[model samples]
Target: MTADARPWTAPVAAGPVTATVRLPGSKSMTARAVVLSALADSPAEILRPLRARDTTLMADGLRALGTRIDTSDPERWTIEPGALRGPATIDVGLAGTVMRFAPPVAALAAGTVTFDGDPHARNRPLRPIIDALRTLGADIDASPSGGLPLVVRGTGTLPGGPAVIDASASSQFVSGLLLSAPRFAKGLTLRHEGPPVPSAPHLRMTTHMLRAAGAVVDESEPDRWVVEPGPTQGRVWTIEPDLSGAAPFFAAALVTGGSVTLGGWPRDSWQPVDTLTGLLTALGAEVTQNDDGLTVRGTGVLHGIDADLSEVSELTPVLAALAALADSPSSLRGVAHIRGHETDRIAALARELNKVGAGIVEHPDGLDITPRPLHAASFETYADHRMAHAAAVLGLAVEGIRLTDVACTSKTLPEFPELWAGLVTGS
Candidate 1:
């Protein structure tokens, strides 16, 4: 009973916008199919799975580590695997995928678990996955500012081999130790020394959903990753549609010149849909894809380019709100770790698109934007759901903007403001 900080005005479109938008599911493949179906061995079935709030706090932190899941079927949930015991406490609510994928499945739980969140999730970065889970043995206590209010102490297992980790500030610490490295005991190799793992397509969708839940994963040694422990064979796990939550309804068809679509979408997409269709076809947006999905029309001229969004960094706040309604300048470099996301999104998109008039500059990793003409202000959203989708694409075309919260778009499009006010009134 929380999310309603009020503010929220952002609606303004009323023009070209066509609209289709179905979106739901794939909050990064439902947090890696709820931590690979809670480290499956048999029972799985996750169908559509994306009931927001960061995949329902990663299935309630793997159901507080005992893992049963069920989720009463929004479309089918089911999980089941148990025996991952723990004195559990996990509430990773600000969810960087439940504080980096539920502390490596609570280090294969046995006793204590703990972990905390939402005070900006203790300045997010969890010391390179708590120093690679203490070099793969896992007894963790972290928080000498390493991040979060940690404590693992589990002793049922976890002695996964070779560690290393410097996931360049979060590739979810090499996908939270390769999604419980096949229930560890000597099943992980992992490498990545430093500086260069910025969402390489979410680590190739975490080694393609850990080789589709059967887990063998070799990755043929580039930044290294071996896996190989054994069991993990769950079964069904559909979830596709969220091409980065269809970037603000395809930036409402490129800021209202109009089309949208995004219905079934998935002509192959583990997210980062061809780098978001080549950054929305280099900001002019025509983006296609058939069988009733991915559309995004708006050629009402918007250009301004330079890109480099480090493997589509969560579509950098709706491509920095379509580069502040582009016409000319935009830079958006390789995302300096989105300044540890959920907040410093390039200094909150250069202080909320230069408080509406947009001229934005603040760069260390990105954002230059320069097309100024916009009016109306307010936009703050530091609670960041992509800064309330860059203040709802700068309120469609800047009217009154507003939006200090928009309930942080319920973490992952909890129906982002009634699907963006029914895509600007085409309701």
Candidate 2:
């Protein structure tokens, strides 16, 4: 199912919400894992892979390029590597992973592949990755705006070598190139020559996953990564639960002075759990991890915080919502790159929060939210999943909060509405 045009009335928490949420697999990890599995030396199995729209699109795109992926089993999807050839058209929806990660993989195909997406997707930043691909010897024709609605003319192989990119706009640009580097003829030595790249942890996740798949990678130096040409080994890849998608549930706990536990988290997480813990702890949430899972308990006292969320920018929307309900003021910085996400998050947050009477000052990189008396209002999601999560968190305390389209959450979490209702009702 796609996004529903009907507006959704967000549920308000009658009391402190207490529940354990079992979220799906991480979209980022699943996307990268699927790509690697398709390019592996042998057939591979991705255990508990995310079946969300974004990941499904990635799988479909790979299938168009002749990779055999059997996703009939929801729990375990199998992949068989084949000759990457394409004379296909790919619809990326609003997924950054599909827009960025799939292009490099498509470059390895034998025919031309036309790429497009939702209307807003054409506005996302794609030039950096497109230019980087060209630097490494791939034929691409981007739109006049240097964004999406482009075509990749593949010649069966890529002459990958040293390349430079300005990835300050999005970390996916770097990860995209690195994910497909091992398949290139000469491998890749990528260097970043711009402002500090956002989402450092995501880049680490990319490198870690690559190395785990038997690719030789060197990240000894800052802003530089060297990937030696080799075959990625097919193995059983168990995807971690999406910590980012769980942010709204955790925020619900914090907002209602309740508790929430997320199950199936790995002992050592590839996601930015440390950063999330620190941010939530700073806002008066007690976080603990053990055999059961990761639990966050609210003390009924929400404190304001000043944080730079560059590395974990994906958490900005929900964190910003928490800031709106804090006792004092909060300032979030170092996420200017989010302007190119599904929407201009900073502006959208400021506009919507302020519409409900929250005092917010929009900055180039982030927002400063001051606690105010919030009331009922219609929150616009702008077709962004994270924005819907933020609205849900705010609705827990502020009654009558409605979302323009809760179905937008289907982009990452299709079960958001049911799960959120259960959390509020303690089902």
Best by TM-score: 2
Q: How big is the positional error of residue 182 in model 1, measured in Å on the Cα after superposition? A: 20
Alpha-carbon runs more than 4 Å astray in model 1: 1-25, 39-95, 107-122, 125-140, 146-151, 157-235, 243-245, 255-260, 263-291, 294-316, 319-323, 326-343, 346-348, 351-427
| 45-149: candidate 1 lDDT, tens digit per residue | 888778888788778878888888988878889998888888989888787878888888888889998989788879877898888888888888888888889
The residue pairs found clashing in candidate 2 are: none
Candidate 2: regions farther than 4 A off: 1-3
TM-scores, all candidates, are: 0.35, 0.99
In order, what is each prediction's RMSD in angstroms? 17.8, 1.2
Q: For model 2, what is the alpha-carbon lDDT of residue 217?
A: 99
